[model samples]
Target: MTEATNDTTSPVRPLRDALTFLLIVSATFGLQLLTLVTGIIMARLLGVEGRGVIALVLAVSVFAAQLSFGGCLPPAITKLLAERGANARDGLGHVFRRRGWLLLLPCLVAGGLMLVLLDDGAAGQRFEIAVIAVVVTLQTLFFSIIGGAMQGEGRLVRMAWVALTPQGLFTIALAVVAALDWGWSATDVLLAYIATGVLSVLVAMASLLPAERGDDVGAERRVPEASLWSEARGNYVSGVRPLDGLGLERILVGGLLGTTALGLFATGLAVSNLCRLVSNAVSVVVLPRVAAHQGDPAQQRAVVRRWFTISLVLVGGIVAVLELLVEPVIRLAFGEEFVGAVSVARWLIVADGLLALRRVLIAALQGQGRGGVASWVELALLPVLVVGIALSALRESLDGVGMSLAAVGLLSCLALGRAVFRAPSARHRGRATSCTQQRRW
Candidate 1:
């Protein structure tokens, strides 16, 4: 199949496909903008210390949410859901029925661990942070699963809504508080954030029900439950384990260095994340497209190479511009209080650019059923990250922490690139050889 191949599960034309990609990019951009605004409001209202608390809570929640997946169910299931005529409802239900309860335990453990280990002399607020972490975990899981379903069905617009709604709602709440000059504390901001998460989940869930009303009429004919889990487990092996560590970085920074440093790092990281706007959208859109060409090794490589180039060129340019403007942007938009974030943001921008490349490569590898290659590379480098951060913190240098992240990102990008561009599998090569002989015959 070519890049524009139309099937029941993917777009039919270049124009429609382009529109789908643009919609996702626009939504992602909007979500990031809202997030930046929320950060600005939080920094202005809560100052550095309060913002640090918020950062820690969010980091813990995200870490726990992704951890509970054991590193593969989301992508694996989403890929299965993309099979033409697969019953989306059955696919979603089967996994939830088997593994749904597994999600809560990680959240509880992460929250409890954070509460026990990190006490910044604010026992009351610390308890609140623990509670918020659990709530945020549930919110993130629901959003991700529902969004994955949307993605699986090629419902790109609905998927984008799932991505945007929570941030949008939370940003509006913060705006109201800012305009009215309400005496909202850090705890109150978290409460509002969780509330929006709940609402967004409800909205996303409702969207699926109506759209899939008859999608499961012949559920037995769809992909089998056993097969789905089997592939999910395969994906699980590919490990993407780096995320487990990345998620824990905030908790580590908070416990080892204190919230003030975390706040500075979080602010800088947030600003640098804007550089990922195009790459993020590209990563999301590339998965199924690459998967669609899985039967043809050459086609799969072409797809991966084409999108990889696009993501690198576009994201590279954005990183360049942001590097020049990040300091002023942080100073003016986030206030002079966050000036400490400038160096953090600069390092993170370089890391984010490298990360943009890594994401596309990882997605392509996953699509090609070679996720194990990427997974092992990431798993090996996981230590480099943990040790780097610890040594950096021992010296009391947040810039060193950021540099460590950039270093890992660069290494992962290069390693994954080599893996992605390596010779096709033996099976594919043999198939090609057979085809050539037959044609000669």
Candidate 2:
């Protein structure tokens, strides 16, 4: 969202909520640091071309999962879970029973395609990549559900453990793989990722287990989340969830400008995504909290404003640092072959900051289970993204892609800004959401 009004008389935020945000931010730091290290190692090992190849593969994997599967289930479940109370168990069970099998196809498709792409490399490589991709994708889904459970339940510290454990495992896996002298090809790296995913899933499951309730009481988040938003939760099959991959920019980039450009662009992506760690940490912790207090539009706007303020404050410093150090960072992290990413990286960090801000507002809307007027405005710009990114890709200009991103980011801020500040009463969204839920049933 845009800059919030400086309302000195805004109510004081709860110390507990502030603390939760800090803990998640701390965990996000650890997670992203681990990821940064992993990316650097992988980039060094894979070289520019191979790194780009993996990026294209990533784009494909994301496309297959988000587009085909309709990416809104987990967060919807999260909001619903908080509001479900006595129905939590039944609601969750119904979700998995009905949709669990649907999850397998997308993961399989992603892994199968990656396997096919690697057919000419090595038989073992193909097998390993396919297996790891499928496993990782599966783990991703499980991780989302478990993490969302924590989010809705407002177990921020526990959620932090779940989020951070995988990264720790990843670092360990990389060390083991390197010690074992498995050359860091895409297959080898992905294999390590799979191992981390398995371990992380175990950690998440453990954290969520009933036995841990005693220990978590110290964090003031021990209660069950079923009662958080009992009255205002959305239908299970709500509107299209804010799945980042649903955007077709990267796939189109790979298709039009070729994989080499994809590689260069992915380099920038690696750097730019670092900015999301902050904003997502905010969104992840804030969504359930806001959703828990859904009815008061004034309180909601105040919460959005707080988040918007945090976004500007954090992003300004992050972008400045990244801009100043872009070249040296790229050179040291991914080497000279990816020097082209420096310019793109600078632009992307800005785009990503705005995107992250937009994400917070989207999470705010989702917390209420129904989007406001601005959500549709953002959706209507989906065509703008397609056309902009496509035209940019066609011109073989990474700069164009960055510019397109900035334009989209600006529009998203305006749209989501309007949403948070000018949201309609719950009545206005009732009919549309009911119709969709009815159709889904």
Q: What lDDT score is found at residue 215 in candidate 1? A: 50
Lowest-sum lDDT 10-residue window in model 1:
1-10
* Candidate 1 Cα RMSD (Å): 4.3
Candidate with top TM-score is 1
Please write out the lDDT profile of model 2 over residues 1-441, one tens digit for every residue.
Answer: 100111224465355556666777888878877877777766777776666666656565665655444344545544454443312233454445555787788788877766555423345555665666676667766776677666555465777767888878887777676667667677667666777678788888767535223343332232233432232243222233332444356666666776567777877877777667788778764565565444566776777778778877898788788878878988887888889878877788788877777777777776555554435756677778778887887777888888788788878878777766776656844653464355231
- What is residue 16's positional error in candidate 2, in angstroms? 0.5
Q: How much RMSD separates candidate 2 from the native structure?
A: 7.0
Estimated TM-score per prediction?
0.89, 0.79
Looking at candidate 1, what is the lDDT of residue 198? 87
* Model 1 lDDT per residue over 143-254, tens place: 7777766666657677776778889999999999999999898889999998888888888887773324565556653557677678667766453356333466677788
Screening candidate 1 with a backbone cut-off below 3 angstroms (N, C-alpha, C), the clashing residue pairs are: none
Q: Which regions of candidate 1 fall more than 4 Å away from where they truly are? A: 1-5, 8-12, 94-99, 211-216, 219-225, 237-246, 428-441
Worst 10 residues of 2 by lDDT: 1-10
